[model samples]
Target: MKTAVSIPDRIFEAAEQYARRRGIPRSQVYAEALARFMAEQESDEELTEALNRVCAEVDTSLDEFGRAAARRVVLPASEW
Candidate 1:
């Protein structure tokens, strides 16, 4: 399928660079990105809803919230 879409110069340049670095055609890069983006969009809505439910439960239980926070260790900025 062939379609024409106009993109900003900066975005085009970045995509071209990424395609060159990955040794793939620009179309393939765009296709992969679009697929990933669509998948995320489809799943994010459900994930967000689940997270909201969990957060609502946390509001009623500080212990649960504390345990959840403790499970995630904060790393130093240098690691990032």
Candidate 2:
């Protein structure tokens, strides 16, 4: 499956370097990166939905509730 796509020069350079270092074709590196990116996008959508649900349950806006939730999870000073 051959297709044409345009990417930034810096991204192309990094992909070429990765392919050479791993001894694989540049297409393989691009394919794997695209797959990972798609998966992460899907995960992010799910996370957003879950966060929205939690916010609704608490009857608060996402921004306000997310910060409050973060503040609740206190870690010892040593952990920092």
- Write down the RMSD of all candidates, one decimal each: 7.7, 7.9
- Per-residue CA lDDT of candidate 1, range 1-80, in tens? 99999999999999999999989999998999999999999899989999999988875554866766655654332364
Q: Candidates' TM-scores?
A: 0.58, 0.67
| Model 2 lDDT per residue over 1-80, tens place | 89999999999999999999999999999899999999999999999999989987995644876877667764332365
Index of the highest-lDDT prediction: 2
Which regions of candidate 1 deviate over 4 angstroms?
A: 48-80
Model 1 residue pairs with clashes: none
Model 2 gets an lDDT of 0.88
For model 2, what is the error of residue 52's alpha carbon versus the real structure, in angstroms, after optimal superposition? Answer: 1.2
